[model samples]
Target: MAAPRAVIVHRTSELTELLARHGTRGQVSFFLEQRGQSLAAVEERHDRTRAALADVTAGLPVDWRRASVERGELARSVFEPDDVILVVGQDGLVANAAKYLGAQPVIGIDPLPGVNAGILVPHAPAEGGALAEAARTGAAPLCERTMVRVRTDDGQSLTALNEVMIGQPGHQSARYTLDVDGRSERQSSSGVIVGTGTGATGWCSSIARVQSPRLALPAPTDRGLAWFVREPWPSPSTGADLLAGLLHGDAVQLRVESDQLVAFGDGMEDDRLTLSWGQRVRIEVADRTLRTVRSVR
Candidate 1:
C-alpha cells in the first residue's frame, strides 16, 4: 500500500501580489502611500503567512508524501481517498477546498490566527504537523458538517458548505416558482438562498435576523437547512407568502420563469450552473458531508 499523502492548499499573500503588480518594493511603497497605508504592515502580514507555511511544511513527517496547490487550482487537483488536506488560510479557504474534497479529512489551519476570526480554521500552524499525522492515522476527531445540494433537471448539480444562491447573475429580480413541503408559490424577487446548518451564521443568519428573533436555525451538525427569499416583490401575478422556511427530508424545488437564472454554491461565482426559462431545480441535503478536524485539546 502507498503511504498516505498530504495536500497543503493556500493562496498567494497580498504582499506578493502587490510586488507582482508594481514590479518593485519602491512602487509598492508609493501605491500604499497614495492610500495612506503603511507598507511595513503589509510586509509583516506577508512574513507571518510565510512563517506559518514554513512551520507546517517543516513539521510534516518525513515518510509522508506531500504536495501543495493554490486555491484557484483546486478544481484541477486530484485526491485519493487516503490523502489528507491541510488548508492554510481563512475560513473561506476551507470552504473552497471542501467542495472539491470527497471523504478526505481536512485540517483547517489559520495562517494568521491572531488577525482572523478562524471560525472554520480551528487549528493554528503550530498544530498542523500533529493534525496531519492524526488525519493520516485516523485518530483525528472529526465533525461532520452538512452541505446544501442544488441540482437542475437537465442533470447539473453542485454542493455548498455555506449556502447556495439562486438568482439573476447581474443583481436583477429573478422570477421563479418555489415549492417546499407541498406548498408552492410564484415568486418575483431578487433570488433565493438555501443554506445548511453550517451556514446559519453567514447569509442565512442575516436573513433570519430580520424575520424574527425566535426563528431557530439548525446547528452545524444538524441535517436540516434554512432558506430565505430576498426582497420578494409581490405583484398581482405573484405572491410573497412563501418567502422563508426550512427544508429537510423533502427537497425545495424552484422553476425558473425568467430568461436566465444562475445557481452557485459557497460563493464560487466562477463555478455555477445556468438555467434558462422553463428549467427546474431542486435543493436538498447532500449525501456527502465535510469531515473537518476538530481540535483535540
Candidate 2:
C-alpha cells in the first residue's frame, strides 16, 4: 500500500521543519496561501522560505509548489480535491477558502504579528472532541457539506452557506408566493430566508425565529427546516422586544405592499426576486452538504 500523501501548508518559518519531518520519506506537497499578500511580498518571502525548506529536507524527494493565484482565482483553485492542503491565514481566510474547497483537511498557521511563523494545523476543530481523537490516530475529519448553486426565476442563481433569500425584490416592500411540500401558503412580508444548517447562525436563525421559534434549540438536519411569519421587525415597542419576537419564529415573511424591497445575505443585497403583498415566498434548507476540515484539538 502507498503512504498517504500529506500537504504542508505554512508560511516560510515552519516550512523547513515541516518538510524535514514529512518530506523525508513519503510523497509530500506544499501549498503556501499568499493570504492576499502583494506579489513582491510573496516573492521575497517565498524566496527565503523556500531556501530554508531546501536546506532542511536536503536530499529528500519532495514536490514543492507555491499556490500563486490572483484573488479572483481563489474560488476555482482552492475548491478542488487534492492530497491535502495546509493553509496559513486567519479565520476569515480559512472560512472563505473552506467555503469553496469542499472542506478538505485544512491546517491553519496564524502569522505572528509582523513576524511569520508557519506552523500548520487544522482550521476549526470539530464541535466536540472528535477531531482530537482523529488527529491522535492521524485521521482527517471532514465537514458536512460543500458549496452549491441554486436556481431561481429568470435564470438566476445564488451561492449560499445557509440559504437563498427572496424578499421585497427591488426598492418596493417584497411580496411573494410560497409553497411547502407542494402546498401553497399565502405570505406577506419583508422577504423569505432559505438556508442550511451552517447558515443557522445568520439569517436562517432570524427567519426561523419568527416562523417557528422552536427550531432554534434543536439540531439542524439535511432535510432542511424552515418556518413562516407575517411581520417584519420595527413595529415593536422596543428593539429588544422586536429581537425577542424575531428569534422565536421558524421563518418570517415581511409584508411590503408598497414598493419593492431587497433581500440580503450576511447583510449584503444578494439578488432581486419578485415579491408582493399576499404573495407566499418559500424558505427551506438546501439539500447539499458543505464539507469542511476541522482540527482534532
Candidate 3:
C-alpha cells in the first residue's frame, strides 16, 4: 500500500498577481488607489489565504506526506488516488482544480469565510485537520457532484466541473451543425454551453435564467444537466429551433461547419481544443464526479 498524501492546491492572491502585473508592490498600491479600492483589503485577503494554507499544512498528520501546488500548476501536477486534496480559497478555485483531477476527495477550505458563496468550499480553515483525517480514512461525507465533458473526433477530451463552452474564443458567431437525439440542423449563434448541476449558479444559471426561466435545473448532486445555445441567429441557411433543454441520458453533439471552432471548459480559454472544418465534438455528462468532502467537525 502507498502512503496517504495531502495535496494543498492554492492560487496566487490578488495582491501577488497585482505585484507581478505592475512589477512592484508600490505600483500595485497606486493602481488600487486609482480604482477607489484600498490596498489594505487585498493585503488582508492575501495574508488570510497564506495563514490558512499554513494552518492546513501544519494540521496534516505528522507521518503523512504532503505536497503543494498553485491552481495554475494543476495541469502539470500528477495526483495519486490516495491523495487528499485541500483547496484553500474561494469556491471557484475548487472548480478550477476539478478538471485536472479524478476521484480523489477534495476538501474546500474557505479562507475569507462568508465573503464568497461557499458552495464548493464548505469547510473553514479551522477544520482543516479534522477534514484531512476524515478524508484520508474515507469517513468523510461526500457530495458526488456531476461534471461535463467535451470530446473531439481525434480523442481529445476535457472535463469541467462547472460547464463547457463551445464556440469562438471571444464568443463571435459560431457556425455548426447541431445534433441531439439523432436529429440535426445547421445553426449559427454565439455558441453552445453544456453545464452540470454544479455549474447552475455560475455561467449556466446566468444564461439559463433568460433562456428558460420556468425550467428547473438540476441540484448540486443531481444527475442531469442544463444546456443552452446563446443568441441563435436565424437566417436563410440556418434555423434557431433548438434553443435550450435539460439533458439526461443524452448528449449534445456538434459538427463544425465553419472554418474553425474551439471548445473550452470552466472559462479556461487558453487551455482549449481547436477544431477545424469537418470536425465533430461531443458534449456529454462526464462519468467522473467531483467528490467533495464535507465537514466532519
Candidate 4:
C-alpha cells in the first residue's frame, strides 16, 4: 500500500524552508495559493516559499508542484479524500479548502513551534480515539467545528467560524432589544456580540475582556454587555441579571428606529434582517460544536 499523501501548506519565508526540510523526510508536499491579493505581496511570499523549499530539499530526490486551484475544476482535482492536507501558515486557505472537500483530513502547522497550531479538523469522537479514527479509519463524526448553523429573521440560515456581531451601519446608535434564553432587555450600543469558543478571541475579545475559565467548558463570562452610547445619554450599564441571563442562553431582542441596522457573523456583513422596535434578537447557546486538533505536549 502507498503511504498516505500529506500536503504541506506554507506562506512566510522561514516556514517554507522548514516544511521543505520536513517534506524530504518522506512527507508529500504541495504549494497552495489564493486568487486575489496584491501581486507584490504574492511575489514576496512566493519568493520566500521557494527559498525555504530550496534549503530544506538541498540533496533529496524531491518533486514539488505549484498547484493553482484558480478554476473550479482545478479546485475539485486538488482536494481529495486520500490526501492529508496540512496548512502551514494562516487558517484562511485551510478554511476555504474545507468548503471544497469535506472528507480530506486538514491539519494546521505551527510555524513558530510551541505555539498552538489551532488545527481544526473535520473529525468527531467515537470508538478508539478521535485522532486515530480520523487518521486510519476515515470515519467522519457527525459534529465538526465547521458545523455552525445560524438562523436570521429573514428566514435564512448561515454558518461561521467566529462570533456574530450586531451593529448599526450609521453614526446613530442602534437601539436593540436583547433577548437571552427567555428574558429580554433593551440595548443601545455600537453592537452586540454572540460568540462561540472558536470566536471568543476575535470580536468577543475586542469588545470586552474575556478570560478562558479553567473549567471543563470555558464559556465566555462577561461582567456585563457593553453598549457604545453616544454622549448626552449615559452608557448602557449591563447589570448582573443581564450577564447571568446571557451566559445561560437567553434570547436578546434589539429594536432600532432606522433600518440601517446590520447583523454580522465572523465579521462578514449579513443581509439586513427585517425587525421592528423592541424586535427580539435571540441569543442562545448552539448545539453544534467545532472539533479542533490539540498538541500532546
lDDT of 1 by residue, 116-177 (tens): 87778889898999899988788989999998899899899999898999999998999999
Worst 10 residues of 3 by lDDT: 288-297
What's the residue-level lDDT of 190 in candidate 4? 54
Worst 10 residues of 4 by lDDT: 121-130
Better lDDT candidate (1, 4): 1
Per-residue error for 216 in candidate 1, Å, reads 0.8
Q: List TM-score per model, in order.
A: 0.96, 0.47, 0.96, 0.51
Using alpha carbons, what is the TM-score of model 2?
A: 0.47
Candidate RMSDs in Å, in order, are 1.4, 12.2, 1.4, 11.0
Cα misplacement distance, residue 184 of candidate 4 (Å): 2.3
Residue-wise lDDT of candidate 4 within 19-88, one digit each (tens)? 5565631231223223343435434555644543343223221332223232223233655456554444
Look at candidate 4 and tell me the lDDT of residue 245. Answer: 18
lDDT head-to-head 1 vs 2, winner: 1
lDDT of each: 0.89, 0.40, 0.89, 0.42
lDDT of 4: 0.42
- Candidate 2, residues 1-297, lDDT tens digits: the string is 333333333333344444556573122233333244243444445565454333322321244333433223444454334434444443233334443444345544333324432212233211212332343245756555422234433343345554455554443333443444433333445545555555555555666666667765223334444433335443332111122122212333333344454443333343334443443332333344444455345
